[model samples]
Target: MTLFFLPIPVNSPLPDLTLADILERTIELSQTAAVILKSYYRGSPAQLEVIDKAEGPVTVADKAVDRHLLDGIQAMCGDSCGYLTEETYQAGDFQLPQDWVWIIDPLDGTRDFIDKTGEYAIHIALTYQHRPVLAVVAIPESDRLYAAIAGGGTWNITADGVRTPIRVTGGKELTKLVVVASRNHRSEGLVKLLAQLPCQQQLKIGSIGCKIAAILEDRADLYVSLSGTSAPKDWDLAAPELMLIEAGGKFTRQDGSLLKYNQGDVNQWGCLIASSGEWHQQILDACLD
Candidate 1:
């Protein structure tokens, strides 16, 4: 294929692209990254080298797809916008000159990817003024894509390109809630918090994208992460957070604060909760108390 990074001259003026135009481009770029991820994923598992990072594992696919997305977005948006991805990101990379930045997790759930579970996804988001205004998540195995723009409704797109509006299930009692938790990074604090919220069932899954998609699809009512040490970074949560909120759900720190993006520090150290809007406050109170 076709690779998408073409550098523009410093004197070149930036293109005036709207949020809708960017959302379309974001979805296109995510699909490109998804194809790359699937190709590498379908290869022999023994050939995949999993290196241990400070947070978890990273594979060749991660780096390759990260490069693809970063380059593609950089070309599409030009050098005036900031860029951050899990593979190329450093401690202080967020200190860029642009007010708008692209945050990405090219291959989320590398552990599940190595295991060949097909639960991995590609995350891409555009944050304006440190808040996400557009987002896209692409699941290669399912050939499904989810996307949303601020003030626009969330949508699910099938392989055939049929799009459907998605929204969270409304107003379920705490006892009737269906909770989703991390498959690989569950913490003791999260468990104790779950104990307080009497949910109907808990579904463990890989990738923040998939878990948040569950909320958008109405498959699960809530997701909570109370990590003390291994909190999710910006790439992990930015796209998914925007999609969830656009689908009429609420996503916030466990204390009910809104999540800000593109900060100098990428670590989200506080507890995070994603829920349908109706019971968000109740769940936050239950988990925090």
Candidate 2:
């Protein structure tokens, strides 16, 4: 692991790190987090600690790893970046430290974590002008990391640091598409939408990161989110959206508009779809029409 993140005392002047520098450090922080999580699992008590938040279940690993990722990024940004994190974010505190913001979800699927499903992930994204400029989605259990920068293609990186360029599958046949759906959050509307897309295979999975990773790896062809009240926040979508789009996929609202982040409310409600881009309009028409 790289040692780019040096411990900085609170209230001291932060070191200046550009987006390029921050991206490298973010990857390192994620790698460190993967190790930290492994330790937590091994030292797991017979009944691990869990808490119910408004969004979903959170564990000790969620809070602790969130703090570490937030701190590591803050140490490099000085006062130039805002932060929206799942554990520490307060509703009104979405202040603009700067136009550039770091959206993070240190642990994305707490239920999957509790179930030992290895479907959880760590999400980190840098957004400017409401779109991601750099994104990293780290799946610790799989020992894989997916990252994308603006205008740069996405890559699938092994734990040993070998990287291979990745792209979405070209499965455009209406009768043969595979769709990955949320394991924990499902609604009637989602069922209807799935039913509408007749002949598409369905896969229920935890963590949006893992679901999108599946699309990029060609394990699945699409994923959809129809939020009802408990909508997904910016942290849920930012990192993986970049990964998918950079991999030649499409992520958008049901109407095919691009997803914009840090728009004050943070909740990404309503119908959102991610497809392989080969037949996105075809799927959109099937689900919407």
Q: How much is 253 displaced in model 1, in angstroms?
A: 1.4
- Candidate 1: list runs displaced more than 4 Å: 1-14, 92-94
TM-score of each: 0.92, 0.91
lDDT (Cα, tens digit) per residue for candidate 1, span 1-289: 1111223112212467656766777788888888888888888876578898788899989999888888878888777778888888876644655778888898888899988778888999888778887789998988989988777778888887777878787866778888988788877877788888867598888988998887777788899887687778899999999888888899998777899987788888888888888888888888767
- The lDDT per prediction is 0.81, 0.81
Question: Cα lDDT of model 1 overall?
Answer: 0.81
